[model samples]
Target: MMIVALMASVSACASTYRVPREEAPPEWREDGKPTGFMPIEGSAKSFPGNHKERGVIMEFAVENERTAIITNTLEWTGPFGGSNIIPAGSPAYARQFSLRMSSNYGSYFGKDMNAYNNPIEWCVPRFDKGDAVCIFWEGSDRARYIDTSGGTPLNASPTSPSGMVGPMPQVQEQAVDFGHQMKIQVIVDTFRSNRITVATRISEGDDWSSLGRTKVMFDEGDTVTLKRFDGEFKLTAHRAGNGEITDVDVEVIKEPKAGRLQTFKDVLEMFMALKAAEAAKAAEDTDESDTASSPEED
Candidate 1:
């Protein structure tokens, strides 16, 4: 029945919109898809040459109307409430593919994905009556969907039309436990490159122990001068390291001119930055209050 709904909802070919590297990402970018897993489709276009994850192999096992199983770790059921056509020529995993991509994944990673892959993958999937399909790759972030119902009973992972709606889940960060204090190193190779590396060391007694490091190559430029890592995330200042994070520690000598080696001086830098931001916000509030009470300009 749900498959029938999909067949009924067809649209013109999608138009492609490539993200310019020089441009800035939109604010309030969505983090992870609010809907946990992305619904899998029958078959995906193979740009295996792109050399990212080909997507883990999964299945669709119908259990109840509300549940389905793919593996011991993966399961699904019921139907995604929304069912609408995704715009055509949507970039697969590119920074601009989804507004939230930048918030957690960073603009650099998105650009790296778009560089070699199709600028946009056709998002519209047509289904015939009784056409059951294989699951979409759960690991793929390119699965930005607003509606999954084509009047069918297919399981869907739906997203808000305006991206994330409602409050975003707060990052529950547990402070990175590394003895006393810790130091973070950010290395940037800025010469028409799209890779960002995160490395950290923790003070142990008197020596600095390497925690772990991770380097993500993006689809574009690095807009982050100094950012707290949060999906692929929350390497925030000196707060906490996400359990899901498995970055290795990196050790690199400083390079002059090209990029600056940003070091977080414990947590003082973060505290001061927060204070500055608060002061700025307070100033703006004062200005707004003054303007509101003043007479309107002609």
Candidate 2:
């Protein structure tokens, strides 16, 4: 019947050129490599306006694999402006994000990159992966990267190339509570010379103690004070040598009733009532010097 209708039209064009083999690709994928929740794709050539209500850019291609660890989760709504992209309960909402890694053969852009100018969207890390393997997010043009889970696991198996690797220096732990002797203020806005180390702990329960240690040497608008004896506290500020700490936190409450101790007790009761009227005029000049040396007083 005409060769079985040309063999059923070449088996329906080889079943439409079969294509079903993509379920082992997740060593790190983002920057428009989406297959599901699709929201990334050239992102309108990098946010082309409507005053940019949303924008997205995600790229993670750790090929010869050097290091490109990524984990991102975001949620947004409401009036949040910029100094560098703020909107999570503004006030310069700082949580953290500034992890950069680039390598076309390395020239720059990898020194444990976490250059926090004003980053705080979530834990963002880019452990320098130089040479080829990539992960890059060029400054927030209204930034956006909706989903990426965990790290390391995408296979093709052809391994043998690892060179540049840098990025592992983060120690942040802050716990503060003031309820007694209370006088805690630590405002450090550094620009240079900054070595602030203030530690305290008083939680009392099965063992949790150490309420002492203060070290300060900040520059810009520096203000440091610590006087505790009233509960929970822990503060740490670092950066005095290898420079790289933009700011630190700590602002406790309640301890404002001194007013110079009621203005020094109203100037010590007006100088003790003017020294008791000059001791009553020196006791009437000692009875007029004992009647002008006696005699003459007769």
Candidate 3:
């Protein structure tokens, strides 16, 4: 029920909020036969569209002395606890959504997925005077909760009148191989449309390759300058090459501008407020129950 619990809040605030782009993705097939593998919702929303739909995808080129704050792989999760809901009207929402959409799939690669504790992860881009692309270490930890199976049980008991508590099994994390280094690339286009497509790839030392790679387009906010790409982008186009679908690689040409960096403070504050409201409602119900159960008064 993580989806239900999280979506409840998202749905309540989604009246005017912009969700990821709703595009019909071509079915993935192998050797021209149907693979019957349809990605989960929100996975393919990384393509071009608008500020709300595609998130912040920036382009970078070689010889540019700017660096993007590469997302911390595996260990990091979205500020909203894997729930995609922020104040839709706030400027922070645009930055947060872009980060979440860009880095949501970093943990699906590698042989051992137990290293990550969060269900989903996001990153905020930063520009620094350095190389076109850079990698950074984010520290390592024991691998636990290999998959979503570690989530709350359907029949879990309530933690309080306002919240539910699930059993946290004492499954100690085991020593596993996890990549803490984040590799980033900013690809610039040929014409000036004020949009950039962010492409990324991950590799585990030489023995392995990209751990859940994806790219999405976003409008360069006021924080950065717009560089010209050769042509315009089609929001509804399918991402395929060589008559078959293939993953994009990390190739670059300069850093166009400085982008925003996302933090968890805003999301944490919102979640706390929602809990306070729930507790207040629960307390009111208790008062009514007490009055109903009282013995007849003189």
Candidate 4:
């Protein structure tokens, strides 16, 4: 009887934690889609040409098998400049920076999906007035949202007279498979006087379960990796510097080999190539116009 009981226990353990057989989903989405949150493109372009962006890019490949790479690029889409403008002691201000995570198959800034496009995952600081950052997941059937602070469904109602702006969707609880392997990247946005703690969980209908590892703290320019696998959980912490990403702690799992971090010189070279191409195109157009307008030599 004891032998039988031991065997049963082992089977249960194996069932609970096993490396995924087929490739896992590109990312772990708590629900189906996000409502209140703006699209990734919208947020990045909020300031027009004045926007400054800094975050890591993750990529997956199928060479020998499935392998992934992470590149941390702290770059501005255009010129880089700024400090938090919210007034001190203002109603719009918060004691801690709000951090939220998002993952997608395409460039977070891209308008279309492509495999060569790196999967963009990063934690962003929400500064929009009256905005609350929340956690979300996408199951096979539908997407769901939850208030990170209150653990409530993120449902919204109409507020404007013109009816142009719709009400925020009310949160509806649902079951989520917490056992699935997940890859999450956390980024630090605003550097305030205080550190911020982030907590996560998985839910099923009205029931919710805590991830074995919960709670992480972050300050500005910090990046951390959160991934779960067969009985093994991995976290990699790092601090971003100019053209450099330094690992903050000892990494446990082996990371896929990576190329050197991009530098300002690389950016300059890109700009130069673009200018040269443009110049060549313009010269060709001018020559064609001259031929069309010139009188016949005879």
Q: Please name the candidate that would achieve the greatest TM-score relative to the true structure.
A: 3
Query: Alpha carbon lDDT of residue 214, candidate 2?
Result: 38
Candidate 2's displacement at residue 185, Å, is 11
lDDT of 2 at 153: 15
Q: lDDT of all the models against the reference? A: 0.25, 0.25, 0.22, 0.24
Question: Residues 70-93, candidate 1, lDDT per residue (tens digit)?
Answer: 211212222333333222221111
- Candidates arranged by TM-score, highest first: 3, 4, 1, 2
TM-score, structure 1 vs. true: 0.15
Tell me the lDDT of candidate 4: 0.24
Give all TM-scores, in the order shown. 0.15, 0.15, 0.18, 0.17
Candidate 4 off by > 4 Å: 1-261
Residue 38's lDDT in candidate 1: 24
What candidate 3 gets wrong by more than 4 Å, as runs, is 1-262
**What are the root-mean-square deviations of the candidates from the true structure over C-alphas?**
22.6, 29.5, 25.3, 25.5
lDDT tens digits by residue: candidate 4, 1-298: 0000001112211111111223224342212222111112111111111111222222111110111111222211111223222121221100111111223542243332112222111121222321322212222322212112221121111111010111122222232221212222222222222222222222223332222222333323453333321111233344355523333332334333212111123323534554565567668968988999999988
In order of listing, the candidates' clash counts read 40, 8, 16, 24
lDDT score, candidate 3: 0.22
lDDT of 4 at 18: 16
What local lDDT does model 1 show for residue 131?
15
